[model samples]
Target: MSELLNTSEVFASDPSGLLRGLHRQPVLAVLRVSERQQAQHQLNLLVEAGLRHVELAVALTPAWVELAIELRQSFPSLRLGAASVRCLKGLAAAQSAGLDYVVSPILEPDLLAKAQQAGITLIPGVYTPSEVARAQALGAPAVKLFPASSLGPSYWNSLAGPLSPLPYCIAAGGLSALDARLWLESGVDAVALGGSLFETSQGPQQPLQLRPGLTALLAWLEQRANGDLLSG
Candidate 1:
């Protein structure tokens, strides 16, 4: 197996650069599949949707590692990462599968240490100052503001004063086009869309049609990027 890059090394390697590229487009589809076949199908749809980054939740059975490995090999340019990785085992599995990064729903110092030691990017989840502080202490490259909707954009805006120097922040959870502009305006590095982007009907095999909602969301992001709505 190839040696995994530690957290610091991964950050130095410009993991955020990869994220910035993905953000420039508009959306990143986070797929949480329970089956390998379904995961593969979702991967194809994401690619078709013009999304270059994906987060595969590790909580899925049969393991998303297998699918992640296959996709990494097939789409070398695609940024494949693991989410819901709360334990060392999950971290190891993600690294072994050649994941570009690992995201957790909560902060875990040991897991962060392991990821750093192994040389892999880590995006620990944070919903409070203490969690953000813990993640920063671990030298996390970025922190995912999970269940972002609960706290709203103001929460992120508040963090900017103290955590401004910290690595990037991504907002996830209950995110939609209506709120995306506000989140970005609040200083998030990027946003991850789950249920808002994928419907159960659009199962693994079915391709995602660029629906009005999705298109509107994309348009809003684009407008923000162009400085039409977002001020710098």
Candidate 2:
């Protein structure tokens, strides 16, 4: 049998191996909600859709701690993480909440070190070579290329040539099903998609309604994973 990973050892060795192992499907569900009900509903939907990884942001009111604990119990196989974490306090809070990983919108050395010491995966945000280098030096498992749409796929392609040794980079911000091919081709390990994956017309007050859009997105991802379509 495969050796079990202790929660604290998730980032101890090859962080990319850990990330690839946790998020093998190449698509991650990023649920940003301000209400308890909404968070639960989205979690259920994503789980049903076969997504094994989800990230909850701390900025969401009502907080995601309770939901994270509940999810850990309900979906033992799912890898839970927290996003929008900007400081050491936020990292501690996320770890206390039973999160398997922590994601920040910006690279913070102190916070990264704290996360490493805590033994949780850290995916820090980076927009330039300096930021990526800093994150790599701090032992980040992956660097989130935020606002990737603004930088375009070429930026990732260019970085890959020089930072080939760096851990996987996840492309977030403005990612959509239509652009998955381009982003994946750009050498990113995976993509984090938000609003584009859900039907927002139902509003936060109501449970998220998965419309045809979500189905289409999933189908596209499935096809890509199956090698039916060019990954790029």
Candidate 3:
């Protein structure tokens, strides 16, 4: 379980194995919403389409939090977490809503410590090697690279030399579903995709849907997990 994160293998320092589920199906769906009902329907579509890990950004109402907790209970295979968790208030809301994990857009040691005390896994955001090192020192189980699409998929590969055994990494922000294969192949533990996954010829940030493109991406990932596709 402590093997280095290869193409399909998992993390080296995941002692609690909180990320084992992600290793099997390596995409993190991050939903940003302004409507509660829309968020619920979107989440239903994702889980119904067999996507396992989904993060409901706190943009939705706290009522959405209740719905998320309920949906997670209904779908035992689903790993639901809170996104944009930057403060103790968000942490309290997630805790009350019964979220399994929380992700932040910045690395705040105080928030990380608070989450740790509450017995929750906090995956902090980081950009530089120093921030990643700081997160690891803060006892983070994983780290999310914010604005990752701007950095490109090859970014993690460059860090492999400097960081050696990189912390379990999740690439988030501005990533489209089409880039999943590229990022996964480039060695990120997971890619947190947003509504950009549904981007069309019209423009970006379309409503979430299980398009043929996304279905194909999910199929490809499953095949990779089953060893039918090339690991590298």
Best by TM-score: 3
| lDDT rank order | 3, 2, 1
Clashes of 2: 1
Please provide, for model 1 over 1-232, each residue's C-alpha lDDT reduced to its tens digit, 9 standing for 90 to 100. Answer: 0122355665564354554455466356677776665566667766765566787777544355676777778777578788889998888778778785778888888888877777677778999888887887777777888999999887876766776555567789889755676677666767888877755465656654433355566666666668943565
Give the local distance difference test score of model 3.
Answer: 0.76
In each prediction, how many residue pairs overlap at the backbone (N, C-alpha, C within less than 3 A)?
Answer: 5, 1, 0
Give the distance in Å from residue 176's predicted Cα in candidate 2 to where it truly belongs.
1.6
- Expressed as tens digits, the lDDT of each residue in 57-150 for candidate 2 is 7653335566667766777767777888998777776877778577788998888777777667778899999898887777676789998889
Q: Once superposed on the true structure, which residue ranges of model 3 sit more than 4 Å away at CA? A: 1-17, 59-64, 199-208, 228-232
For model 3, residues 1-232, the per-residue Cα lDDT tens digits are 1243453332323422458777778788887655556667777777776788888787445776777667667667777788999998888878887886889999999998888778787889999889988987877888999989778888887988778778888999888777777887887888898867543434445654565556677888888788834654
* lDDT of each candidate versus the true structure: 0.71, 0.71, 0.76
**Residue 213 in model 3: lDDT:** 55
Error of 1 at 3 (Å): 30
| Best-to-worst TM-score order | 3, 2, 1
| Model 2 alpha-carbon drift over 4 Å, by segment | 1-18, 59-63, 202-207, 211-232
Q: Name the Cα RMSD for model 2.
A: 5.4
